[model samples]
Target: MSTTRLFNVYCDESCHLQHDGVPVMAWGAVYCQATETRAIAQAVRALKTQHGLSPAFEVKWTKVSPAKAAFYLALVDMFLADHRLRFRGLVVPDKGVLDHDRFDQSHDDWYYKMYYTMLRPIFCAPHRYRIYLDVKDTRGGPKTRKLHEVLANSLYDFDRKCIERVQQVRSHESELLPIADILIGALTYSNRGLASNSAKRAIVARLGERLGSTALTRTSTFATTKFNILLWQSREALG
Candidate 1:
């Protein structure tokens, strides 16, 4: 009998376009046991109601503002305080430096590779995972299918048992996806060296304080399961 544990991974990305005018790109996911998702989502809705926002109100990084700074901070607090939740983020400090031609790959190819790198650490034997990515564009369907194939092939899970599913979903539909948005937003903002939005800056500072770190731009130790971050550097940058 297989006593495999099920986990749901909600993924989000920030400034991922090759020429988005933003140098830093980040990908993040917030995952929890499959059984806990319903409860966690309910809790999030309850927080929204307590904060005087409509239950249907979408929690988003772009929605973070001075008026709702307190609510956003509370959201961060809630996420960190919850033992069942964990985060993993991968940051690319400068996408402009990437040489896809030299690597003999397209940007889309590298994009999938980055997703795999961001998610590889979360997979373990005997544990099944269902990945949910926020729909980015019209290509969402194809991207999801390709990503599923890539992840499964990389893990040698050809039967797709360990990597159960990879699907595209609207961020507004899932309570957890917004959490990933904010986390990824903070990483990209910090790495881009932006401070124009005080509200966003406050949230970033709160994350640092909660994690006992002065800066979010730095990478966290790989073993830091609670809120792991990887500042990815390309070979050229490494050299």
Candidate 2:
């Protein structure tokens, strides 16, 4: 008689490569009740159509431009207004400062660790989750398996009842993945102190305004459930 609720989590990352030239790296996830996934995605497609864009059009942060600002902003507003959806982001302000040698771990090991840290808070007992990560590269399959193992082990869910599965997915195939990209992109942009793209800047500002924060550069309080952000500081930075 376990009345466990099932949830679907869509995850995305921005500039997570070890030597990607981008100093800031961010990972974000947008999750909702399993039953609502289809309706939410259809609503997003409807908004695209209302904005005169094709329903097949992908909503992406990189594609945001002055011409599509209204559409993108409306998308953000829609996400905020919907109580069913929730976002959590983890920002690594500076990857260059990481000392892998000292930690006795490779960059990939740390990468998975960061993913675990970002996701650990979202898991609660008596609730099951299926996580979908946007495929990043050729290692997507192996990464997914490793992440699944890590999460399941960490949670002591050896039977895989709580953490049901972690799978790789194409961002274009999932309506919710792009939303994660948008939020992660904003965190990365803000942390990198970039101002080259006016459209992106506006989106970041609007997100902060909607969240009642002056900036997205800072870590949101732990109590923030709607759009939670964790500005992760390395041991070196903390020292």
Candidate 3:
């Protein structure tokens, strides 16, 4: 059996913020086994070649065009299924649930914090996890540094757990890392600004009920936790 100690996880997020009147929505975390990382890298290299993706292409190049973006989205799902890799995250911010002002004030940062929290529990046990977070902002400013600091601060306990490290990489150079990024982006576009209350509830419920049922560790602990997070969010929104 493949031990969990050698796992290297890559995570990305989309629609993570509620700047201005924009509704917050959709966050995703995708991962492959540490042992399988090399294989997954090879697969992505082949896909890039087949699709003529150049090394010099800008980050989020797949997102520049709709058709090409969708293709990569499908490709990501295919890779996950093929490798039996498990993932868990949420699509949030439909109308009446999340207001821009409220979200900003809460300082929750949804998936940014959620991914950190989720990874925390996994890294809790005596195993090592080297997590790679794909940089969402290339703008090179305070916002980007804040994100780096958040990730670093979140992993403060990992050094004691025999866990080696946490890293952030540019989305484009990260190859397979952007797959999760695009999935969340697609989710955001499909939900359309999270303006519909019914759609928001349905999306959150599905994430909790379905996506959370996936196998992450020897047990489906994290998936179950994700479901609970969805349910808790719903209750909090309702009250």
Q: Name the candidate that leads on lDDT.
A: 1
TM-score for each candidate, following the candidate numbering: 0.97, 0.97, 0.62
Clashing pairs in model 2, backbone N/Cα/C closer than 3 A: none
TM-score of 1: 0.97
For 1-239, candidate 2 gives per-residue lDDT tens digits of: 66899999999998889997888998889999999999999999999999999988988888989999899989998999999999998999888899999989999999899999999889988999999999888989999999999999989999999999999888889899999988888888888888998889888889878886544777778788999888899876879
**Pick by TM-score: 2 or 3, better one:** 2
Angstrom error at residue 15, model 2:
0.8
In the range 146-177, model 1's lDDT, one tens digit per residue, is 99999999999999999999998898899999
Model 3 lDDT tens row, 1-239: 53445666666665455554556454455665577767776666666666677644443523435435434544554554564354554545452465436556454565346555545544444556676776545643554445455665666652335445556777756656765664455455444533334433343334334344322111244445322222114446668
Q: What is the lDDT, from 0 to 100, of the residue 95 in candidate 2?
A: 88
Sort order, lDDT high to low: 1, 2, 3
> What is the C-alpha local distance difference test score of each model?
0.92, 0.90, 0.51
Number of backbone collisions per candidate, in order?
A: 0, 0, 0
Off by over 4 Å in 3: 1-4, 55-70, 94-113, 118-124, 137-159, 193-235
